[model samples]
Target: MGKKKSKPAPLPQSLALPYTGVESHAHLDLPPFSSDIEEVLKRAKESGVRYICNVFLGHEAWKNNRHLFEQHDEVFFILGTHPSHVDQCTDAELGAMRAAFAEDSRLRGIGEIGLDYYWDHFPRENQKDIFIKQLHLAKELNTRVIIHSRDAAEDTIDVLETEGFVDYPVLWHCFGGDAELAERIVKNGWYLSIPGTVTYPKNEEAREALKVIPLDRMLIETDCPYLTPVPYRGKRNEPAYTVFTAECVAKELGIDTEELWTTCGNNAIRFFGL
Candidate 1:
């Protein structure tokens, strides 16, 4: 064989930074890294990630897998029923989540809750009902809310505004809209969690949109095992991959990587009250 091309190095291997970056959202409890959870967590820590926020999909997942991160205090939690999974949002489940929040100090917020009009099978009415329930619960607990809206931004904002959530501790998780949408969210005093999708080549809308997101109101997240960033787009994502997102976002904003990374981490810290 002629000259062989060398494989690309992992993002973290080349990304140099202090151990202060926080992964605003992740799903390590998922099955992708079940065999090497320790390695994954260790890799994330070694990659300059200070903490990782694990979002539990529902009460059952939280009840079953919260222990996996018990020894790893750096992994905080946001538990809620996803809009698609409203079937599980029973009164018993709500009571269980409320009890869990009270019993576990690590449960920091209510999240991954809101409208997902992208999926037509799930009725909008049902999604709205459960989302309102969780919003009310978050208000009752006096905790932060992490919203997950997809293709339903108007109604989502309307519902939140009607519920008196403007200026509240709310985060629009996995934000991928245009600059106008970003500006609107900021106007409402809500934070936006930018995901790895911003690194995609064809996502010019998102890349350009990111320019308008205020530094203090922005947070970076892997949303792992889902929107893996560039150079690793075809592979499973993890908290360790947050560096690539930080890199992309920092470049897009024409700011220093370390500065953006630390600022986003601080934003998440303040949002979650960690």
Candidate 2:
């Protein structure tokens, strides 16, 4: 008799959404699994996270993934060229983004659109141009913004100040700056989004930065498919893992996780204008 074949090992449930809450931010477009977005989302909802703010940072996925937001009532999206993609963008592309966003109520904000000097591929001036343009568009639309700043915090803050966005709801997503920067940002009344990077043992700067962020201004994210939290580190992250980041944050504040979750969830609702 032929030997029986064992069934394929079950895929990890980490990508599945938990049943408890919502996820603040995730890049659902990148993957070894973008092709199976529906299945991934099904797992996400089954896991408990009821909604996700899917950030688009350029790719074929951006063009094709619009349907995912429409197909699922629980999903929302943001559009903009990422700092790294600034060089590849043209004026026409920016115009297109403005048009698309102007037409879609679900396309909530302009984002993933701050500065990064981490690599030299894109010139500083080019990143600034695109960043400022998108910021202006967001301001005109009276929409929220998701800023992506890495190694260019001062320049990023300068742009915001120059643009007179003193009252706009700007979220410094995946904030990893030191306490001083956090203090400055908090003074400006801007918000900070804590990612799984906050859970890493080596991110002392981010851990310290958390001290300055008041509870009302705090938001949570996974920046998923990257920055997976501990115990699940080196794995793909999803909304369910937001709870872990929330736990780390609560521990930092000496508050209970339930209180943190409720507060952060409320912050998210208000910031996203949901």
Candidate 3:
């Protein structure tokens, strides 16, 4: 008879941290969580995640699916056109987002916006143009700005600098670079949203980079339905997994896990104004 295959470990529930951790970024409105969002939110709350910032990739996504979290007050919103989808952006869509923000008290930020060179799915110039437009919108509305930069760090920073975003309330989301990059981001007076990718075994640079990131300047996230942390790395990610990322980050920084968790959580809450 063939031997039985081992089952994956169950979701973590014993981190013992207080209900103070915030999932700084996530995409719970995506299809992966469509069937189990209620359970996912419950698990997240049980894992001590106080709030979750659910990112809507663009105006249509926000318009169509913003109702998913209506019953869950702990979930907030960040709306913007992602780099890959910049081709779909139009003036009317931008205007709609502005109107929604004015009408929705839960709309806390304008983001998941920036350059994405990895896919090259859209024209880089167009991406930069839409990115600047959104940045200006964030400024006009005076809301938090969350950035999604991948393989386009230099241009991202350059555009932000040129747009007078230096020393502004910007968050470099899903940071996957070295300590040097971490230093540069914080040096520009911006925050870094560390995702579950940091928990991977081979990402030594990220682990080492955590040493230089100040406690108050970093936040944790699942970026889910993607970047699930180790032990749960191959599984579909959810907001409940933020604690595992926090655990890994705390160990690298040589601090108490609970302390690091709470500090990062507080940093997220204050930064996103949740």
Query: In candidate 2, what are the lDDT values of residues 1-274, reduced to their tens digit?
Result: 9999976423334433234355777888776556877877877676556668888775344677776667888888888888898865677777777777767777777888898898745889989998998888887777888899988999999999999877579888888778999898888889888888888998888888888889889888888878887657787777667777877888888998777777887788788877
CA lDDT, candidate 3, residue 17: 73
- How many angstroms is residue 45 displaced in model 1 relative to the true structure, after the best TM-score fit? 0.7
Clash count for candidate 3 is 0
Residues 1-274, candidate 3, lDDT per residue (tens digit)?
Answer: 8999988665667776789999988999999998999999999999999999999988788888988988999999999989998987799889999998999889889988999999989889999999999999999999889998989999999999999998989999999899999999999999999999999999999999988888899999989999999888888999888989999999988899999999999999889887
Worst window of 10 by summed lDDT in candidate 2 = 9-18
TM-score of each: 0.97, 0.88, 0.97
Sort every candidate by lDDT, greatest first.
Answer: 1, 3, 2
Candidate 1 vs candidate 2: which has greater lDDT? 1
Tens digits of lDDT, candidate 1, 1-274: 7999979856684688778889998998999978999999998998889989999999889988988987899999999999989999999999999999999999889989999998845899989999999999999999999999999999999999999999999999999999999999999999999999999999999989888888999998988899999889988999988899999999988999999999999998888888
Query: In angstroms, how far off is 137's CA in candidate 2?
Result: 1.2
For TM-score, the strongest prediction is: 1
lDDT of 1 at 116: 94
Badly placed stretches (over 4 Å) of model 3 are 1-10
TM-score of model number 2: 0.88
lDDT computed for candidate 1: 0.92
Task: Pick the winner on TM-score between candidates 1 and 2.
Answer: 1
lDDT of each: 0.92, 0.79, 0.91
